[model samples]
Every structure is written in structure tokens, then in C-alpha cells.
Target: MKRGEAAEDFPPLSPKACILSSRSGSRMNSTELGHRLIRHYPFASESLLNERGIGIYVPPSYYRDENKRYPVLYMHDGQGVFGPNPFSNSSWNVHRTAEELISEGLMEEIIIVGIDNYGQERLNEFAHPLQSSGIPGAPDIICKGESYERFLIEELKPTIDGLFRTLPDREHTALMGSSMGGLVTYNIGFRNPHIFSKLAVMSPYFVRLDLNTLREIPFYKRYPGVNNLALWLDIGEIEANILVEHVRGVVEELIEQGFVFGQNLMYYEVPALRIPRRIGQPECDRRCCFSSGSRAKQLKPSCTAEKKSD
Candidate 1:
């Protein structure tokens, strides 16, 4: 038998094993994974920014047509976007989700840019500089969110726009993530409204040590006047209530700042089981997640967002 055909010719040990082997044979490899993924890595020039690389997901059709321009969504927890790896138990299955969405035409074809985090510095980089009390075990580390934002706006965005035919306007730009990444989604969207018009925050880590400082964010003052911004906020009910409450507090502040519930903001609490397999890995025991958005015109709010507010 030929070397490539050897496996196909091998005798099966048992019916069950045969089935399992067949399934394993169909598994995707890294290159195959890359093709299935809209992959791109853009460099950053900011100092101390080691993980300045980003992975972008363009739908399969994106490669076939040169004239297509797609919306752009920036996601955090780069390693967790595609599949479970040795380093992470949970993944967003972003590639699979994007493929499905593109196939269904439910959403406009989009470009997903996964921003890899600098592990130890992730917490610091994602949190606002003034908000630091809630993050445990990192009292001395100063927040670098401002610098991180600069890297995205001044460096990453321009690079992505230049390389790909993306809709480079605020209405088409979005930010998303879970946990700390979720928090950053809200912070970045609100802080830089001109750049990001859509915000998706899943299971945000809002209970940081300095939650109080977020109240002073300037976006709060400018939110009401902002147009075309949509917000999607979802949280798991069984995860950590402290985090949920913190998210609620932030939403309240935004509301107080003049954002209408269902107009500029949409929030949801998803069950642990139904929580998208990608966002919470099979091993993750938490049962809920949360998210937010800015552009109301572009988003068709999910059913979960209509749930009663806490």
C-alpha cells in the first residue's frame, strides 16, 4: 500500500474504534485550520508591546473576490478564538462561527482580528489605568490600557485597513472579548467612540480593584450624542456574581450618562451549557457571560438581551 494509503488500509480493531479513527482522520491540521480561518498577523511599533501580532479571520469567500470589503471586529484572548489548546480550556470557535454566519448571510461578512495578549501583562493592558483595585494579586502593576488603545487605533487599525479591504469607519468597527478582554471591549469602545462603534463584552471582569475610577471616563459625557453605535453585553448567570454586578454597575453608569437600554445598549445572561462552546471551553465550569455594544442601527438584538435587567 502507498504510504498515504496505509492508514486507509489498516484493519479496524473494533467498530467503535473504527468510527473514532474515521472521525480523527477528518480532523483539521494547522494549515487547513489557517485556510478555514481568515488569518492575518499585523505588526505594532509601540514600545514594550511584545505581543504586537494579531490574527485576522476573513471568510473563505474573501480570498476569491478582491472587491469585497467587510466589517472588522477586534477580539481579545487571541489564543482562545479558534480551538482548545494546551494553554486554554475554552475557545470562542470564532472561525467556525464566522464561517456559519457567512454561509447563512445572517450577518455581513466580517474580518475578525484576534489580538494576542502578553500573558502577565494582559490584565494590566486590558484594564483602564485608573481602574485597578478589583484585579486580584496585581496591586503594584500599573494599567497600560491607554497605551494598548494607542497600539490598536494608531498602529493595528491602520495596518489592517491598509492590508485588507475592510470597512474602515466607526460604524463597521467593533471590539469584543470575554473576561478581562470583555472589560477592555467596553473600555475601548466607550473611550474611543470615533474608532469603535460596536462593542461586544462577554463575561466582563468588572470587579477590578478600582472600579470606582471608571465613573470618570469621558465617554460617559459624550455617549448620548454618539450615533450609530451599538452595544452587546452578555453574562453567564452561574459564573461569578461579583463580576456580573460589576458589569451591571457599569451599564447603569452608561445609562446615567444617557444611553437608552435597547437603544445603544443590549445585555444578556446566557446559561453555562448554552453558552457558546467557543467562549467557555468544555472544562470551564462557569454558567454565564455578559457583553455590550455601541451601534444600534446595525445590530439585531438577540433574545437574551431582552431579559430583565438585574
Candidate 2:
């Protein structure tokens, strides 16, 4: 039930192969729903540890409302976000869910960008650079996520912004992922408040709650360039249960650092469950996102307000 346990077992994938790897004919299922789920290959990159493909989900409104600029949500583990999982043959169906919400007027129109992991290197690339103590189940940081973070800020975001009609500001952009991906989301999202102002840290394996780790976190004071960030943090029953306490520890630290609940920071947990606002409702999206059976409007807040970098 650890972060990398389930998906990591897949055989190591070749970076070159992944560049060409993509789902069959459904490439860009220009669906009847009016939404287009497009998969583009050969997204060559040198800054990242591996060169890979990109999956872009353009909302129906993007096509319908010609002049509008949409917010962009960047997600990790492209395969699980919307397509069939190689391991379980299931998927997040994010495209369908987002479409429903937008159509129902429950959420704003937005674009989704999914980044495929390079198999084994996923853990290394996704590792958040923070280390206080070793996590029992979580793997130790291998590559320390520096390259991955660079790939996101330097190579990936710029490319995505250029090609798509994105808001291109911190407030209009978000970063999300679960488990290990969640850890890196905080590292990248919180650290780079000037770029990504929103974040969704679901079932993050914070690993070490030790004093040393807490001291290393830079959120103790109001960080410059991060004036108005809306953050969402949560965990579930099975896979996330093991790391729940650590998750709480991180939240407490954030709260002490001045992130107000119900305003900019929202934390949800239940030996039992899962945000609520029309613009960035976490509760509405919980069922739509975590539960396979449930559907939108699931609004997972995963972006940041743009700020001038210091």
C-alpha cells in the first residue's frame, strides 16, 4: 500500500520506447461529448531524466468558446490519469469527469496535461527532495526530484503554454499527483509559488515527521511570491492509511506557517473520507476522482496564482 509499490512493479520502460508508446487508435478520441482526448508522442526532452509522451485533454468549452483562456492542470502518471492502466486495466477517467463538470456548470473550463512516468525512474524522478527520516515503506530518494522539477518548470510548462491556450499564470496553473507524486507536488508547487499557485497533495508519503525534517521545511514564514495559494491535501483508507499520521504532521506544520483553513488551505481526512467551492471544490471532486463508481462534478484544486519570482 506504499506510494510506488503497486505501479513501480511494472518492468522498467525505455525512455526512447516511451516517446513512441501510446494507446491504440483512440489516440485523440474526438468524442461525441465534444471533448478531445489527444495523445502526442515524440515529446523529446533533455532536461528531464527521460524523454516521453504528453497527453492533453482539451475541454469541450475550449473548442466551443473560441476566445476563452483556460486554466491548466498538470498531472503525474499520465496512464492512470485518463487512460487504461497497464497493471489493472482501469483508469481515472479524468477526461469524462472533467467534461461532465464543465458541461453541468459545476466547474470552470480547463485543460489537462498528463505526464507519463518512465517506469522505474518514476520513483527517482518523483522523489521530493525533503528528507527528515527514512520512511518505512516509501523508497529512499534516488534522484531527489530536482531533474523532474526542472523538467516541469523549464521544459514542460513552457511547451504546454506555448501550444495550448492556457492562462499561463500561477493562479491558473496547478500540479497534482498521489503518494510519491504528492510529495513532489508539494516540493514543486509550494517552492515555486511564482509559477504554480494551486496544488492537490493526495495521499502524499511525507515519510519523515521527525524534528529535523520539520526544520528543513521553508514554509515557517510567509513565503514571498506565494501570496494567494489555494492548497488541497487529503488521504484515503487503504493505500494512504499507512502514511496518514505523517500527512497530518505536514498539514499541522503548514497551518502553523499561516495557511488558513477554508480560505487558502483545506485538509480532509476520515478513518472515514475526503474541499467545497464552485470554483475549487475539493469535496465535490473527491467522489468523482477517488471513487471509481462516482462521477462529477469533482473539483480537485491543483494550481497556484502567478507571482513575480524573487
Give the whole-model CA lDDT for all candidates, comma-separated.
Answer: 0.58, 0.59
> Local error of candidate 1 at 301, Å?
7.1
How far residue 47's Cα lies from its native spot in candidate 1, in Å, is: 3.9
Off by over 4 Å in 1: 1-30, 34-44, 131-138, 209-228, 273-310
Quote model 1's TM-score: 0.70
User: Each prediction's Cα RMSD?
Assistant: 11.7, 11.0
Q: Which run of 10 residues does model 1 get worst, by summed lDDT? A: 283-292
> For candidate 2, lDDT tens digit of each residue in 83-192?
67585565666776776666665566678887878877887787744444322334444644777888888877876776667899877888887766777787788779
Model 2, position 65, has a per-residue lDDT of: 64
lDDT of prediction 2: 0.59
